[model samples]
Target: METAFADYLDEFTRRDWETLDPEAVADPVRVAVVGLGWFAREWALPGIARSAYTEATVVTDVDPDAVETVAAERDVTGVTPEEFRSGAAADAYDAAYVATPNAAHLDYVRAAAAQGKAVLCEKPLEATLDRARRLVAACRDADVRLMVGYRMQTDPAVRRLRDLLRAGVAGDVVHVHATMSQTMLGELGGDTDQWRLDPELSGGCALMDLGVYPLNTTRFVLDEDPVRVSGRTRTRHEAFADVDEHASFRLAFPDGVDALCTVSQNAQHASRLEVTGTEARLISDPAFYEREDRGFAVVRDGTRVDVDFDQVHQIEEEFAYFGHQLLADEPFHPDGEHALADMRALDGIYRSAETGRSVTLDEDAA
Candidate 1:
């Protein structure tokens, strides 16, 4: 049980994945999937199915046929949006996962809060800053737990990286450069007419859909909100004329920490995060993605230590964490307030992009 100095210096990461493991219990949390969209049907539903602390009990959608299809496939109750809005089938599940578009999230969140059910809504909170504030308030007023679905916060590797950084492995992080991009239309078989391309539905294009990964992840790892932000965006394709096809933002944080994050929907796939510090540097390739193999490395004094973490279903980790925390009557990190701050930052980004000026953020954008 004795430890070597080399072992301590080279590889001494603590395990931080207890939430991902299955919990011993007589009953797991029951969940409802609202919005049978592509993400819900193909990604979120599968993630829920794989969760150890939760199980899907009801599937709801605006489209009756899609709801019925997913319900039959998963052997769960199918509730129409109208039915769900009216509080029908409310007893089927203890929590609701709202996967609807940005603007539509409030309705489902309000409805879930009204029924005294816990909620796990997808990130960005809502399409607009005002709506996001109201969404958080709705949950607050009802005294319901509103966990935002930010899966990167639940990644084991990311947590370990955060641990190392916090332990001074990378001393005094000064700057970060992160980028996440993928071809979502014209080349990736993504529907050209999807809601993502619609400015109203998706809020923004590349920034809202993809850029939030870097913004929120950086915020999570640093645990520091940005003091100010500057943003720029580009639109080339007709499908994204009203929104950004490529966007970039520079965030200035406390303690002299700063980050420049970029995202695009027309670029070759890339998800990378590079951190710089006074003593060392850390880099994570394929960082934003959970399904892909991640390459994480720490370099100190011209020496590099690399780790290839085992692939994990990040979506499952998020749901499991939510269910476990909700069952234990504990507060989760990525709750409604946390999401509201992200919305605040995002709103600043948009304002900066439009005004061609750096926007200062409120310290307590509550």
Candidate 2:
């Protein structure tokens, strides 16, 4: 049995959120949400509203009704996608959160950069590798910082996982198993016309939408990029004709570290990740949903230590971090260039699945 140290009992509880005062931000970043989808309306806008460093000032979508409803409900300006792309209501925002479908991300991001606004483009970067490359180049050429919307990176528990791994708390990481799935098809009533089912619009299906959470989160926690990947995909439903329905992939990283990940679009809602190392193991259950109450634990030496981080909202933390970095003129991790690595890896995964072989990212990296 491990003895409980009592010498520092008084210094027990701490609050990280209290340290970063929202009022300390002299100028909060006014944000324009470019997509009026459910994520933008429910998650992005609400997160920005709750953030100390950011405010949602503008909302836009191709659907005027969605724009009107959200803008009116939130008391923000609403514009058509074309108007937003044309830089109308430019003063309303200092940054743009591009939440449009994967294929449409480039146009909006390019427009935002042209308007001298920083970008927080959602994950997968864009629909495909070639377009993702162009998107990153557009931001680079325009000289605006771009950060991909990987909210887990800003989550406290995930950050602590990274810290622990770096401190050798997990010893030498050996293997990781990650699985994430959701009833997205059932939610939308098996709508095949949706962008998620459209390969041209969504890049891939379950892998791109759900599996990327584990894939990217593992990369962030390990601080290592995958050198090679092998994947097998399945399309069991008619809705997944043009895209993957379920996918299982293997990612091989440097230093003998490897991760196996799986995702499904029409299955029971579940997300889990377990990392095993020589000294300790890290586990996260219900890990991928940013809005859910997830649990994390570290187990070793015949003991299990469950972490109880403050239940901070992932999207809100992401907004605050992005805004604070922009205000401080600092660079963003998982920035455009860094995000391209994920894009390349995803592309390689798809290629490997198609060719029924393994794919190495060295050629893409080179």
Weakest 10 consecutive residues of candidate 2 by summed lDDT:
1-10
Estimate the TM-score of every prediction: 0.94, 0.93
- Candidate 1 lDDT by residue in tens digits, 68-138: 89999999999888888788889899999999888899999999999999999998789888889899999
Give Cα-based local distance difference scores for all models.
0.84, 0.84
Alpha carbon lDDT at 148, candidate 1: 93
**Residue 146 alpha-carbon offset, candidate 1, angstroms:** 0.5
Model 1 segments beyond 4 Å from truth? Answer: 1-23, 186-188, 363-366
Off by over 4 Å in 2: 1-20, 188-190, 363-366
> Model 2 clash pairs?
none
Highest TM-score against the true fold, candidate: 1
